[model samples]
Target: MTLDALRLEVPDILQEDAASLADLNEQLAEARLQPQEHALQQVLSLLFRLNRSAMTLLERQRALQSFSEEYRHYAAAYCAGVAPPILFVRFCAEIATGFKRLLLQILQGRQPSRPHLAWCLYMAQHFLAQSLLRHYQLYQEPPASLWRDSHLLYWLGEHQECLDEPVAAAFQPQPANTLRGLYQQMLLLALSNPFHLAEGESPLLFSALAPLASLARLLPWDVDDDAEGQTVDLTESQPCLAYDQAPEGDSHYLRRFELGALLVALHEPAPLQSALERQLLERVRHHWLGRQQRRHARSDHAGDCSLVVGLTAIHAQLLEHRPGHCAAQMLDTSPGGARLLCHADQGRLLPVGQLVLLLSSSATPTLALVRWRHLNVEGLHLGLRYLKGLPRPVWLRRAPSAQTHPGVLQSTPVQGGGWHHGLWLPNEQFVEEENLWLQLPNVHNQAALPLPAPNLATPLVARHPLKLA
Candidate 1:
C-alpha cells in the first residue's frame, strides 16, 4: 500500500509484511528438528511479528484472530510452567504498555514514537493474552471452568476484604454481569511490568518495550451486557431491557467509574464484581420488582423482573420484563383485537426530547406510550415498544465507520451510531463500534468514522484486543 493510503483510509493497515509472514510460516514448517523449547519461542516470535504487522496494516481484527491460538497456547504453557511463560509474560507485558501509549499518541495526532515500529510489539503481546487467558482457567485447574467456580481465583490480602466504600449515597445496583472482575484481571496482569524510562533511558529502548506493556491491558471480552432489546424512555410506564440484560454492580459504582474515565484518567482500571455477589443482588431486585420466576415453571406473567443500567452514569434505564403478550388469562378471554404497526427505528436522537413512539405492528401505523395497567384495561400486546435496545442487546452491532485500528480492551464503545466498547488511542477518538472508525471520510475530527456503503459488509480489520485488568 502507498504511504498516502496509510495516511488516508486505513492509516494503520499494513500489508507489506505479507511475504515476511508467509516466509516465517514456511520456516516454522521446516524447523522440525529444532528442540521443542527453541521451536516454541521461534514459533511465537514469528506469530507475534505477523500480528504486529497486521496492526500496522490496519488488519487488527485479523491479527487478533490469528494471534488467538498462539496467544492462548503460550499463556497456558507459561502459567502452567509448561514453558518459561512468566518471564516471557513479564517481557511482553512491559512492551505492550508502550504500544498502548503510541496508540494514544496517534489518536492525539502527536508524532508516532518509532513510527511503523509499534505494529510488531503490540501484536506479539496481544496474541499472548488470547493464548493465555483461556488457560487462565487452567492455571487454577480443578473440577470445572472458572465461569462456575469462585475458588478459581482467591488470594490472601493483608488489607480488609470489603471494598473501600465510596463517600456518597450508594447508587442502585448495576444490571447483572458487569464483567468487571474479568476486565480488571486483564488490566493488572498485562501491565505486570512497569519501567521508569528515566532521563538516560532511550526512546527506542522504551519503545521496544511497548508490546509487553500492552499485554497487561489486553481485555478478553467486552463488558458483559445483555443483548439490547429496544431502549426505553424513563418516563414511559415501562421500559424494555437489552435482550441479554445488563451487567451487575452498584449503579453508582459503574457511574463513578465512567465519570472518572471520560475526562481524566483514561488509562486507569475500574472495579470488580463477582457472579455470586451479582446473583444474590439480582434475587433481591426480583423481590423488589415484586416479580418472581421459576426455573422450569412458566410464569403466569413473563419477565416481571426489573433492573437499571445507565449510559454515561446519566442515561438511566429502569427496565422491566413481562410477558410478550398480555396476561395469559386476558389473552385467552379477550375477544376482538386491534392491529397496528410501530417503527422499529427511532427518529433523530433528540438530545433533550423524551420521545416515546411505539410503531404499532398490526395493520396500521400507530405510536403509543405505556400508560397505567388498570384492572379495567383491555388489549393484547405482542412484543414491547421501547425507545431503544438494551445494552449487550441482541444483535449488538457496531455501526459502520470510516477507519479503524487495534487498541485497549477492544470493548464496543457505548456511544451512539453503535456501541462504543473501547476508545481510539491515536486521535483520542472514542468510537462506539469498530466499524465507526471505517465510516469516517476523514479521520480529522476524531469523532467521525469512514464507513463503506451500508449494504456491503464493511471491512473488519483485525484489532488487537486489550484486556484491562
Candidate 2:
C-alpha cells in the first residue's frame, strides 16, 4: 500500500527565461546532427547505469560536469558551424542523457533540498531538445532508436517527482498501463481494432498509432461519443488548440483537466513535433539559457509549460498471455480500462487488488496502485493510478475503483509536459537558493545542486572521462 497520496505544494518557482533560450534555440536548430554509432552509443548505455551507481561526491560531480561539458562543446561548435549533422543528433541525445543523469541525482537526494542545479539540468535538457527538433525534424522520422532502450525509455516519472514534490504519494488504486501496453496495442491495434485504421503494413507503425487513439479517448468530454473506451472524434471534441488562445474563445475551459501537459509530458514527442516543436524549443532554451525575446508567433503556446513524457523501451520484458495469465505474475490496466498486461513476459495470473511501487529508487521509492481489469487473448489490464497526473492538476481520466490487494514490484516508462499552470505554491512556501529545491527548507541537500553548467570545451582533462585521474 505504498501508493499513498503524496502532497506537493505548487511552489511559485523561478521560471526559465524564454528569450535567452530562443537564442540558444537558434544555435541548436541550425547545428548539423548525426546519430551515435560506435563507442559513444555504448558509453551512453553505461552512463545511465552510472547515474545511480554508488560513487564519491567528487566522482559523481565530475561525471555530471564532463557529460554536460560535452554538450556545451557540441553546441559551441554548432554555433561555429563545425559539428556534423549526426553529431548534432549525438549532441541532443547526450544532452538528454545528461539531463536524465542530473534528474536522477535530484530524485535520489533527500526531500526539501535546493534544486537549482536540478532545475539547470532540466533547462539544459530543454535546450538540447530544441536542438534536436530544429535539426532532426523528429516527426518526418523520429529518432526511434534514441528511445528504443526500455530501461532508458523515458525517465519521466523522475521529472514528475521533482515537479510535483509534495503531492507525489500514491493515489486511487489502478494499474499503470505504461508504454509496453501502448506499444503492444500499437503493434496489434490495426489488426484487432479496424475502426482505428483502414489498413496498415508496418506492425510498429500501427503500434505507434494506438496511443493517439488512447489520448483521443482520455479527453474530458461530456458525451460518451461511444465510451467502450474507444471510438471518438478526438480532434473534434477537444479540438487541438493553443493554451493561451482558446479555439472557441473558451480558453479558460481549455486549461481544465491538465490536458495540455499529459499529452506533452506522457505521450510521444514525434507526433507533436510538427505542431509543438517551436514552443517546446523555446521552453528548452529558457530552461538552459534563461533568456527570452518576444516575437509574434502563431497559435499554440507550446513552450513555457512543464512537461512529462513516457516512451517505450527498445528492450522490453516478455509477457505471455493466457488464463488469468500465461505465467503467474502481475497485471496492469489502462486508465480507460480497455487494455491489461503483466510484469513477466510469459503472461501470468494475479492474486487480487495488488498494490506495488512502480519505480522503486533508493532516493524516492514511490509506489503505484494496480488491479486486474480483464484477461483477453491480448493481455491483462491492471487498473492504475498516480501516473494520470502528479502532485496536483490531476487528469480527467476515470479514477479506478477504490480497492486494495497484496503487493509486488514493477516499473513503467513515462514523461510529462506542461509547466504553465498547476497547483503552484506561492513564493511564500519556499526557502530559495539561485532557484533550487532543498530538504527541511533550511538544511543543505547537496545532491540538489547541479555539478555545474558543463563546458564540453574543457578537454577531457582526465584520462578516465568521468573522473579526475
Candidate 3:
C-alpha cells in the first residue's frame, strides 16, 4: 500500500523548519511537567509530526533515534511500576503508527542508499519489537493490523537483501537485518513468558537474545515438519499458531520457526552476568522448544472469590483484618493454578507478576501470583498460580531503630513434602544472608537470616528463605 493510499492525516504542528532537534528538546521539556500518559502522547505526536515534515533522510534518522531514546526512558518508568491500561494500550498503538510511517517511507523509495535503508529497517523493527513486547507483557492479543504491517515489512526486507549480505544497525551490538533474523527476534519474544517477568526484565531478556536470534530458522509452515515447533500466521495477530491451530487453507502465509540452533547456543558456556539472567535464558529456550509440560490438568470451576493485590494491600487484609478490595468469579481450577474473571476496572489494578490473596467460601485463603491477564467487553480474565504455602502477615525490621516493613512468613513445601520457612518482603527490602528481626502477632521479635529463595513470579516482592539466627 502506498502512503497516499493509506491516507494518514498530517498533524497541524507541521511548519517551516519546525522539525529540528532544538524544537523537539523544548517540547520534551514541557512534556515532563504533564501527566505521564499525556506527556507520552504529546511527545509521540510531536515526533510523528517531525518525521513527516520536510527534512533530509539523515535528519529524519536522527529525529527517529532521539524519539526512541526518549521513549525508552518513559517505557522504563512504566515497567518499574503499575501503569494505566489506557496508557499501555496507547503506547503499543503509537509505536505501531510510528513504525508504519517509516515503512511507508522506505517502500516509496525515499531511502537514498542501501546502508541508509538498512538502518531505517532496523529502526522500524525496533519500533515493532517494542510494541510486541508491551502486548506480551500484559498477555493481550495483538490486533490484526499489527500482523498485516509486519507481513508487509518482512516482504520488503526479503526482496531487498542479497544472499548472505550483512545488515547492521547503528549502536546495535549484533547484526539482525535479515528477514529471518528480524522475524526470529519477534518469535523469541512471543515465546518468552513475559507475564512472569519482573519489572524491567523484558528489555534485559531481549538484549541477551539479540546475539542468538539469528540462529533460529524460519520456514514455510508445513504440518509434516515436526522440527518446526512454533507457528506464526502473518495474516493474524494472535499467539503462536501451534500445529493444532494451523488452518487447512492459507498455509503459504503461515511460518514456523525451529529453535535447534538457538538452543545449542544457549547451552554453550557464555559470560552470563547473573543467576537470574541464566534462569531467564533457560526459560526462553524451554518455551521456544515447546518443553513446558503442564504438571496439572485444569478442570472447569464455577464460584466467586474475593482478592487483595500487592504486598501492602495483602498484608493489610491478612494482618489488619480488612476486607478484600475486589471480587472475581472463578473460571477454572487446577492443582497448581486457577483462572478468574473480574471487572476490568479491578483487573487494571493487578499487574502481571503481582502477589494476590484469594479468599472463597469453599477454600481457605490462598496466596497466588497473577500469571496472566486479558481484558474484554465482559471483564478481565486472570490466570493465577498458587504459591507453595499459606502466609502469615508479619512486621520486619533490619535494626531496632529502623522503621518496620510489612512482610509475609510462610512454610513453603520443599522437596520430599518437607516444609521450609520463608519470608516475602517488598522488593529490594531484604538483603541476602542479612540478619533481620521478625515481629509476629502477640510474640516478641525473633532473629532470622534473610537468604535468597527461588525466584517466584512476584515482581513487587522478594522471596527469601528464613533461617533462625
Instruction: Identify the leading candidate in terms of TM-score.
Output: 3
Rank by TM-score, highest first. Answer: 3, 2, 1
Candidate 2: stretches off by over 4 Å: 1-58, 80-83, 112-114, 117-124, 127-131, 134-140, 143-469
Tens digits of per-residue lDDT, candidate 3, 276-318, equal: 6677788666667555677899999999888888888888888
Off by over 4 Å in 3: 1-39, 47-113, 162-179, 272-275, 312-316, 347-349, 375-379, 388-390, 394-406, 412-420, 436-457, 463-469
Q: Across residues 377-431, which tens digit of lDDT does each residue of candidate 1 receive?
A: 1322222223223222111113433233422212344455454232212222343
RMSD of each: 24.9, 29.0, 5.2
**TM-score per candidate:** 0.22, 0.25, 0.76
Q: Which of 2 and 3 is ahead in lDDT?
A: 3
> What C-alpha lDDT, on a 0 to 100 scale, does residue 422 get in candidate 2?
18
Q: Single out the weakest 10-residue window by summed lDDT for candidate 2.
A: 460-469
- How well does candidate 1 score on lDDT at residue 304? 24
**Candidate 2, residue 344: how far the Cα is off, in Å:** 37
lDDT of 2 by residue, 1-469 (tens): 1111121111121322211222333333333243334434544444444543555434545565555544454444333222234545654555555444444555566662534433433333343333323232211122433322211221232334432222111111111133322322221222222211111112223223333322422234343232222211112221123223323433222212222332354334565333433332332322111122333222321111111111111001111111121221223223322122443332222222222223312213222323223333454433333322222111111112323111111223235832321111112222222233212213333123212222211011100001110
Q: State which candidate has the highest lDDT.
A: 3
Off by over 4 Å in 1: 1-19, 28-33, 47-60, 76-87, 90-179, 186-469
